[model samples]
Target: MSTNTPTPGGPSLPQERRLVTAIPGPKSQELQARKTAAVASGVGTTLPVYITAAGGGVLVDVDGNSLIDLGSGIAVTTVGNSAPRVVQAVQDQVAAFTHTCFMVTPYAGYVEVAEALNRLTPGDHEKRTALFNSGAEAVENAVKIARTHTKKTGVVVFDHAYHGRTNLTMAMTAKSMPYKSGFGPFASDVYRAPLSYPFRDDQLDGATAAARAIDVIEKQVGADNLAALVIEPIQGEGGFIVPAAGFLPALQDWCTANNVVFIADEVQTGFARTGAMFAVDHDQVVPDIIVTAKGIAGGLPLSAVTGRTEMMDSAHVGGLGGTYGGNPLACAAALAVLETIEADGLVDRAAKIGSLMTSRLHALQERDSRLGDVRGRGAMIAVELVKAGTTEPDADLTKQVAAAAHQAGVVVLTCGTYGNVLRFLPPLSISDELLEDACNVLDDVFAATK
Candidate 1:
C-alpha cells in the first residue's frame, strides 16, 4: 500500500542476505576484542557481528556479511533501521540545536511528540503523555502517576513478565538469572499473579485464566491497596506470550471495578509491531495508562507514558520529567516514526508480516513436535521449544537452534521464562522473499538438529 521501504544503507547495501565469510568474520572478531576491553561485562551482544550498515531486511556486517535481520534490534527498528524520515528528522533537528532541556526551555518537538502519542495510543478519552528515555523509566513513572492518582501503594504484575532493568522494574519482572540475579532488595509492594499462558497452562480458557489471576490478586493483595495492575498486552521478554482471548478485557474490567489504574506496558508490542497499532486493540481493551517505547521513535531512545488527563495531571508539578527525558532529537525522530506509520500504512504491513511468519512457523510445528507452540500477532511472533511428545521446555535446544541460525547468517533471538522460545521481530521493511528465506533457514536448522 504505502511505498516507504526504508533504504537505511543509502542504496549501496543490498537487501538480500549475502555471506562473504563466516558468521563472525575476522573483522567482527577484531571489534569484539576491542569491545571486550572497552565495554562493561554486563553489556552483552546476541550475534556479536558488528553492523556497518542495515536497511530493508539485511544488516551488513564489518566483513561484508549481509545477514537477514529478523530481530529488528529487539523490535526497536520496526520502521527499519535508519528509516528515511527518521534519519532526515534527526539530522535536521540536531543541526537546529539539539537540547535546550524541556525542563528549562521547552520546545515544540516535545509537545508535538506528546500530542502524537496521546492521539495514536488506544483510547479516545482525553489523555496526556509524558516522555522518558527508556521503557523502565516509563514503567516506573507510570507507577508513580498511578500511585498519585489512586493514593495506593501496591503494584501488580503478571508471572513471566519482563518490565525492565531498573531496580523498581527488576522487582516487577519475573525472571531472575540475568534480569534480577544479584540485584537484590528490590522495590517493595510489587506483586506477581498468574497469566493466561495457553500452551503451558493445559489449554486453559481465557475467562478461567483471568479468574485464576483475579483470585490471586484479591486473596493476596486486596484491591483497596493496589495502585495499578501493569501488564504487557502481549508479554515481551518473558516470551512472546499472547494471553488467551478475553484475558485482557477481563483484567481491565476488574481493574475498573476496583478503581485501580490499568497500565498496558506496550514497550515491545507498540507502534504496529503487533499488526494492530497497539496490541490492546486486538481485545479493544483500553488501559488507564499505556507505556510505549521500542518502535516509538524508529531506533532512537524514547519512551512515553500516556494516560487519562486527570491521572496524568495528578502528579504534582516537578514530579515528572528528567534532564534528557524528551530530547529534541528523540522527539523529532518520534514525530517522523508516527508519520511513517500512518503514511506508509505500516499497520497493515505488520499484519501481513505476522500472517507470513505464523503460516511458516505453523507448518514447521506440524513436522516437528519440538516446536511446542507458535503464537504472536503481526511481526512479533515466537515458537516455544519443548521435548517431543510433552510440553516440557527445551531451553537447551532453543540455544542450539538460535546459535545455528546466527552462524548461518540469520539473526534470530531466544526468550521465555524457560529460555526456550525463539521470538521473531523482523522489520516490516523485509520483503516476502527475505521472510521466506529466513523461514527456510529455520526449517533446515530444525531438520539438521533433528
Candidate 2:
C-alpha cells in the first residue's frame, strides 16, 4: 500500500510484501507437518511460513509469498540477509579453510575481529576480547572472568532480563515459563534486582530506581561479595525496555566503587542496531565488560566478551575457549560485517529507522488505547498491548494482532515477560518503502483487531 520506492544499495531481491495464499499456504503447511514429525516440540517457530530465501526487506517463502521481514532473524541481520560483504567474506574463507580450531591453530581473522571489537566497544581504555560461539557462551565466560578478577562469587542481574538459556545464564535470567521452566538447580551466587520499567514503575525517575535496586543488592547480596553486575543496555527478550536515563550510569558508578565489574549484555542491542554502535553509547555509560552477539557477525554465530585488559587477562591460560569458538568462517564474516557497518553508515541508518518506526507507532497509539506503551530505540522498537481502559496486559490482543499481520504477509515478532509486547527489528538495509508497507499492514491489523 505504500508508494515509496526502495533505496539503492539494498539486496537485489524484490522489495515488496505479497501474499498469494492463506497465511501458511499449502506448501508451507506440508513442510510444517514434516517439521512436526522431524523436529522436537521444544523448538517452536514464530510463523509456520517456510522461508526459502531472504534478502533486503523480504523473506521469500516456499509458497511464493514475499513477506516483509521485520524481525531480522531476531536482530541478527543488521547488515541485511546474505549481505554482499558477508557472503563474499564467507565464500572466500570457506574456500581457503573452514576450520582448523582456533585453539590449536590461530588465524588472523580471529585476531582481526578481536581487534575490531576492542576498538569499537565503548570507552577508549585498553581492552581485551575473547570470542565465543553464542551470546550465552560469551556471558558465561564474562562471569568467569569477572569472578577471577575480583575474587568474588556473587553476580547481580535485573528483573525481566533475558541473558541466555545455558545453565549459568538460566540462573542469571529472570523469566521462568519457557526459558527456565523445567531446568532446575541453577548456578548459585546469582542475584536479581529491580529494573527501571518507566511505564509500569509509576514513572519512577532513573536515579530513584537505581537507588532502590542498589539498596536491594547491598542488603541481600552484599557489595563485598559481588563480583559483577550484568544488565542489558536495552533489554531484548524481556521486551525492548530501555532503562531510564540515569539508571545505567548510576549502576556503573556503584560497580566501580565496589570493585565489581560492570557487564553490559548488548547481545540483542549491539553492532549499530541501537542507533549507536552499542546501547551504552546513548547514555555515555562505559561498561567494564560488554557481551555482544546477534548482529555482530551479520547472521553468523559469533559472540565476544570485550572488557578491561586486566579483567580479561585475569583468566588463567586456556581457561576460556571451545573447540569451535571463533570459527574461521564466522570470524571472516564478522570482519566483513564490521566493515559494512562502518562504510554504509548503518548507525545513522538505525536512527532514521527508529524515527520512522516511533513516529508511525506513536501515531497509531494516539488512536488505539490498547497500545499501552511505545518504547525502544533505533531498529529495535516495541509496543506493549493492554486492555483499552486499563494498563492490564492484553496478551490475547497481542496474539491476534500478530496473527493478523502474519496472515497479511508481514513477519512480526512478539516478546516481553508478559507476552503482550509486539517488537519490530527490521534490517538496517531495509528500504523505506518496504518498512512503510509493513507498518501499513500493522495499522490495518491493529484496527481490525480493535
Candidate 3:
C-alpha cells in the first residue's frame, strides 16, 4: 500500500528485483523445482519464473530480479499492483470479513460494485450489472442473457480473438494451440468473422473492411439467426489489433439494424487500459452488453456483464451470478481502483503511454525492415515482428526480442495469430523515468536484433 517509489531510504539494489542468482534466481529456481514437483504441467507460464512482490510497474521476482512489468500480469494491474487505495480497501475489507456469498447473505460491497458498473459501463439507456468469478463467466452470462432475451442461440465472434479458456469461451475464442487445442467439441453456435487487420488486408478501406466482415454474417450466418455479435473493441490477445476508425461504428450499426445484441469484450481494454473507461468510447459506440475484467478489480479476480436494463432484466431473477461473484475483497479493490483512476488521471496516463509507444515503435519501424507494424490503442500497444521487408511472420524473432528484453530487466509479451507481436501494458502509475528506461531496453533489443 506504500508508494511504489522506494521509501526515504530505499535499498540501493532493488529488493526482490533483477539481481543475485540467474533470472530464475537461486530462490526462484528452488521454488520452480518445488512447483514442478507439485504443480500441473498443463498450466502454462511466461518468463522470469516467479515474483515475490509487485508495485506500480515493477515486479520483484523470487530471485530478486526487479522487472518492469509491461504485461501487467496479463492486463490485471492497470491501476498498478498494490496501489495504495486498493491495498487499504482490501486490507480493511479483509479485516472486517471475507465472504458471505451474495446468494446466501447479500452485502453492501457487492451492491456498490454493481452500482459502479451500471454507472460507468457505456449506454445512456437503463442498465443492470451482474458479477462473476472470471471474464469467461461474465462472457458466458452475457451470452445467456442474450439468448434468453432474444430467444436465439447463435453468437458471433472474430478470428484471432482470445475470449477465454472455459468450454463456452473456448468456443468463443479463436486461438487453438493453448486454449482450444483439445478443449472441444466446444459450446455450439458460435460463429467467427474476419477482423479488419490493416497490415494484412489491403483490398478494402476501414469502412469496406467492416462491411466485408458484416456481409459474411448477412449471407452465411444470417442476422435473423443471430442473437449477438461479440467483439473486442480493440482486440487484446489477438495481436493487440485496433480496427480502423469506421470499423466499430459499422459493426454497431449492423448489430443495431439486425437487433443483434452487440457485446464489447473490454476485458483487456477497459478501466483506462485503452485511455477510455471503455474502448468502445473511442468510437462513441455503445454496446448492448459490455463485459469487463482484468483491471476491473486491480489484481483481484472479479468480472461483470454490464448491459442495458431491459436486456439484462430479460433473464429471470435467478438466472445470473456465482458464489464468489462479488467477493468483498475484490469489490473493495474495484472501488479503490475506480477512485485511483479518477484521482490520478490514469485515463490520460494511458493516452500518454499510447503516444509515447507509437512514437518510439514507429521510429523502430522506420529503421528496421523486420518491424512490420506498430499498432494498438492507448496503453494497450504492440509491435509486430516480421521477416525483413516482407509480410511473412517471424514468431522466432518475436520470441528472441521478448526474451532479450526480459534478460535486460523489462518484461514483454508476444501475441497474434502467428505469435509475432510484442504487446505492452506498463502500469499507468509508472514514472516517466522508469518508462523511458523500459523503452530504452526495447530500443536496445531492436538494435541488437536488427
Candidate 4:
C-alpha cells in the first residue's frame, strides 16, 4: 500500500529542503568562536561550521542554514542522516539497553553484526569478524592480525595512503603536516612504496607500476620480513585516486606469491560508497582481509576486520577487542545500513553519482586550466588543482575554491598528499536535483577563482 519512489514519497529522503541564512550563520559563528577558544588549533578543520540536524542529502547547520551535504559526515552517513529505518533501529536498541560489553556478556547484536560483516565482505569462503570503535582501531588490529598470521615484522604502505591518526596508523599514513608531523617517533618497521598514480607517473603501465612498488618493498624491507600489503582500492583522505586498472590485481598477486596478507582498507570506500559493496570488488581482487568502518554502521561508530577465518584466528585467545567495540546501538545501526544499501540500490546510485561528478569535473577541467585532473571510481571523485600549464600543484587555489564554495552555500572538502585536490563524497542517496545545484555552485566558484 506504499507508493514510494526516489522522487517524493521516498521513505529515506528529505521531506523538505530549506536554507534561509548564509552557511554557518549567526549561531554557527558564535559556536565556532567558542570552539576556537576551547579546542586545539592543531586539530585543523576543513569547514569551520557546526551541524545541528540532517536527513537524506541535507545538513542543517547550528545556525539553521540548510546546506546540501556532499561530504556525508566525511563519508560516514551514506544511508543518510535520520534515515527512517536506521533511526528506528537505533531507538529500538537504545530502549533495549545500550551496552553490556561483548567480552563480558556477549550479545546477539554483536554476533549478528559479525555475521553480517562475514557475509558482506569479499570472498565466499568462511570469514571471521572483529569489531572496533573506529577505522583507526580496525587498521591497527588488521596489522596485528596480519603480523600474527604471517609471523612477519614489516608492513608495507604506499606513498599517498591515509590509514588513520593513531600512533601506529600515523606510522602507516604518509602525510606529513597534520597526520604525521611531530607525531613521531612512531611505531617502527613500517615502510612506504610508490603508488600507481598514472596522472603523475605516466611513464609506467599498471603492471610495471606494481612491479616498481614490489621492487621497493623487496629491496628496502625484504619479503622475508613482510607481514601485509595494505591499500585503498580508491584512496580516500589522501585524494580520490583510483590506481590504474590492473594495479590491484597485480598487487594482490604479489601478496599471494610472497605469502603476505593483502589488506584492503575500505573504511572510506566500502558499504556501497564506491558502486560496489566493497571497492575491492571492482578489480576482482579479494584481499586476505578487508578493514571497514565509516558508512558501515549508518552514522554510529563501528568498524570490523573480516577475512579468512584462519588469519583472523591467528591471534591468541582474547588478543583483540575494545570496551565500546560493537556497542548494541551501533550494531543495530549497522544492520540497518546494510539493509538500506541493498533495499535502496544505493550501490547503483554510487555509480550514478560517479557518472554525474566525473562528467561535470571533466567539463570544468576542460574549461579551467586550474582543474588539472579528475579521477575516482563511483561517487568517490576528486579534482586536482594545478598551476595552469603545468602539473605543479596549486594547494592555495584549492583552498580558495573550498572557502568560496562554503561561502556560496556549499561545502566541499579538499585533500591529497599535497593538499591540492577537491574531493566529493556526497551521500549515494542524494537527489539529482540537489546534486546539480551543488555542481552549479562549484562552477560559479571556479569561475570567480579563475
Candidate 5:
C-alpha cells in the first residue's frame, strides 16, 4: 500500500492533532456563510469546519488545524481516509472507465463485491447480494426482498432505531423531530418494538428484554403478517447501544420460527467496527438479510443487501437495481477495503481500540457521576451523560463536551435518542498515542463540564 492521499488533489496528510488558529477559523467560517446562503437549512454541520484533507486518524481542515478524528465521519472511513489500497484501486478503475451502468453493461467489480459479501457475511448458507448507493437504499431493498419472500407487509423495527432518511426508512426510524417529525405520512405497516438497552433497562436481562420485544411483535403484528424484523446489532445514531447478550439470539430464533426475515442493519457496525467483521458475529446470530455500508468501501458511497439465495431471488428479475448501484470505482474501493481489513487484521485492532477507550472512559466514570454509562465494543464506543445522581439525560452537557473537544482539536461526535451520548469511532489506522491524546482531551472536557 502506497502512503499517498486517498483523495486525488489533496496532499498526503500527517497523522497527528495540531490546532493553528481556532476550531472554525476564518476560512471555515467563510465557507459556513456560503453554505448558509447556498445550501438547504435542513442540512446541518456538526463541527462547522470545512475539511481539506483527511488520512490516518486526523482531519486537516481548511484552517490548517489537524483535528484528531474520533468520529471517522460517522464510521465511514474505517480503513482510514485516503487509504492507499482504495486510492490505488479507485484510480486504476477510474482510468479504465468511470461507469457503464452495471444494469446496462455489467462489470466484474460488482460480481466480485457480491461474492465477497456472500463469503464475509455470517452463515455458510448460499447467499446473494445486490449493491446500492447508501445504507437506506440497501435497507429499503432488504425490506422489499423480505416482503416478497414471505408474502407479508408488516415490518418491525426497534425503539431508537435509525435505518435511514428515505420515506420507508423514515417510517422505520424511531426518532421523530429531526428524522421523521414532518416527513409523514410515512410508509405504513411499520411497527416499533422494545430493544434490549442494557443501560436504560438495568432491571431486565437480555432474555427478559427479548421476551418483551417478542411479545410486542406477536401481539401487535402477528408472525403470519410480519415479513421482517430489522435491527442494528449495535444501534448507531440512536446511540452505540450494544443490545444485551441473549437479546439478539432470542430474536433471531423467533424470526426463524416465524419465517420472518431477520435483517441485521450493520451499516455502522459492519466491517470490523465492533471488534468483529460484523456485530452479529459477537453472538453468532445469523440474520437472513444483512445490510452493509459506510465502512465497506473506505469512505466511498456504497452499500449492499446480502441474504439467503431464495429470499434474495424472491424479487422479480427487473425488481432490484439502480443506475449507479455498483459503480466500478466504488466496487474497486470496496475490494481494496476488504483486502485492507484482512491484511491489516483490523478486527483485532478495533478490539484493542475498544479496550483502551473503554478503560479510559470507565476510569472517568468513577470520577464523574454525570458520565452515567460507558458502553460499546471495539472502536465504536460511547458515554451516555446523565444528571449526576439520576438517569435523566444531560443533552446540554453532551453538546458542551463535544464542543470543547472540537475546540481543543479533537473531532468527537454526539448521539443517542436523548442526545446525551458522546460517541467515538476513530479509524483503525489511529495510533495508541493519538487515542491517548483524545482520551486526555475528553478527560479535561468532562472535568470542566458542570
Candidate 6:
C-alpha cells in the first residue's frame, strides 16, 4: 500500500479506529430509541450509530467510538466528511445569503457549477447543465429532456440497474422487494434489458452481451419509439457490476444510430469515486446526458444533468426546475468540491485507493474458495461471496462477516441483487495504514465465517 498521509486540508482527526464501547453503545442506543419514535420505519439505516462528527476516514458516534468509514456515506463524501474547502465555502455563502432561489434571482455559484460540469464531463461537444437536489431528480429531468429532444416515449434501462427511489425512478430500478415492493402502477414506456454481467452470464463477451441487449430493445421497445437509454457506467447498488469491456461503447453506438439519447447515471461513480473523474471516462464512452450527484458536493444534496447543448436547449424555460433545484449553499459546496478535486489531485488518489483495495481483496480471494469474484474500479470495489466450489450466493455468510466487522470497529456495507456482495467505498483522503487495518479486520471476519 502507498505510504501517503491523509490529504492536508480536512479537519484533524485521530486517523485510527477506536472503540470505547460496543458497536451500538449507550448513547447511540438512546438516539436509536428516539429515531424509532420520530423517524419512519421505512427509512432504514445500516448501522444505528448516531454520528456527531466525521472527517479523515472515521465517523465519531455519540458514544465516542471512532469507526473506520469504508462506505463514505454510500459514496457521497468522496473528499472526506467536512472537507475544509467545502466547509469554508458553505460558511461564507450562508453568511452572505442562504437562498435567493435560482429561478427567482439566480446566483453566480449555480452558474459556476454548471460551467465546471460542462467542462469536466465527457466529450468535446457543446454542453449545457441543469442542477437538481438528488440523483432521482436528475434522472427524472434527464428522461424529460430526452423525450423533449427525440419526440419518443420509450425509455430503456438494464436488468440489475438501480436508478433511484422516486415513483418514476422506482420504475427504472430493477430490485423488487425493497425499492418496488407494494409501489405499483409504475410509469409506462420504461423497458428493461439484460446487462453484461460477466460472472453470471456464462463468460459472455462484450459484443455478445451488447447484441443480446440490442435484440431485446429492438424487439420489445423498438428504437423508433425510444427516447433514451439510461445506465450506470459502473452499476452501483446492483453489486458494483462493471460491464464487460466494449459493452458500453457498443450500446453508445447503437443509441447514436437510433437517435436515442444515452444517459449515464454517474451519481455514485462520478467526482473521483472511481479512478477517473467519471466512470464513463474509463471506456471513453460519452453519453448524451450525464446525471451526477452523490460525491458532487462533498456531502451536500446536489445533482446535475449535463448534456449536449442542443438536447438540453430543447426543454422549455419554465418546464424544468424546482423550488430548491440549485440551493446556494449546495452550489457553494459543489464549487469547492470541484476545486478540491483539481488542487489535491483526487483523481490520482482514487486510483491509489483502488489499487490498495483490489490487491488486498485479490489476495483474500486466492485463499478462500467462498470468495467468488472481486470486481469494481478505483475506491469503489466489492467482493462477491459464494458457497464453496459453487457460484451460489452466500448471503448469510456475507451478513455474518459484515456484522463481525462492525463489531470490530470497522464500518462495511453489503449490496447486490443477490445480497451476497460486500462493497467498500473509502474516502480518497483515507490513509493507507487505516485501509490496511480495515482489511486486516475483514481478513479475520472472513476466516471466522469460513
- The superposed Cα distance between candidate 2 and the true structure at residue 171, in angstroms, equals 0.9
> Which stretches of model 3 miss by more than 4 angstroms?
1-18
lDDT tens digits, residues 309-340, model 3? Answer: 88999998778878889899999999999988
Candidate 1 off by > 4 Å:
1-12
Candidate 2 lDDT by residue in tens digits, 200-302: 9999999999999999999999999999999999999898999888999999999999999999999999999989999999999999999999998888889
Candidate 4 clashing pairs, residues 3+ apart or interchain: none
Which residue pairs does candidate 6 place in steric collision?
none
Lowest lDDT 10-mer window, candidate 1?
1-10
Assess the local accuracy of residue 182 in candidate 5 as a C-alpha lDDT between 0 and 100: 83
Q: TM-score each candidate.
A: 0.97, 0.99, 0.95, 0.96, 0.97, 0.98
C-alpha lDDT of candidate 1 relative to the true structure = 0.92
What C-alpha lDDT, on a 0 to 100 scale, does residue 287 get in candidate 1? 95
| lDDT tens digits, residue span 1-450, model 1 | 112334432333566777789889999999999999999989999989999898788899989998989999999999888888889999999999999899999999999999988888888899999999999999999999999999999999999999999999999999998999998999999999999999989889899999999999999999999999999999999999999999999999999999999999999999999889999999999999999998998888899999999999999999999999999999999999888888888899999999999999999999999999999999999999999989899999999999999988889999999999999999877888788888999999999996
Collision count of model 5: 1
Better of 4 and 6 by lDDT: 6
Between candidates 3 and 6, name the one with more favorable lDDT: 6
Alpha-carbon local distance difference test for all models: 0.92, 0.93, 0.85, 0.87, 0.92, 0.93
How high is the lDDT of residue 321 in model 6? 94
Local distance difference test, candidate 3: 0.85
lDDT of 1 at 345: 88
lDDT of 5 by residue, 1-450 (tens): 112223222226765678889879999999999999999999998999999888888888998988888999899999888888889999999999999999999989999999999999999999999999999999999999999999999999999999999999999999897888887899999999999998889757889999999999999999999999999999999989988889999999999998999999999999999999999999999999999999999888999999999999999998999999998999999999999999888999999999999999999999999999999999999999999989999999999999999999999999989999999999988877788888998999988878
State the displacement of the C-alpha of residue 93, model 5, in Å, after optimal TM-score superposition.
0.5
Q: What residue pairs clash in candidate 1, if any at all?
A: none
- Model 6 lDDT per residue over 330-380, tens place: 999999999999999999999999999999999999999898999999999
Between candidates 2 and 4, the TM-score winner: 2
Instruction: Name the regions of candidate 4 deviating beyond 4 angstroms.
Output: 1-19
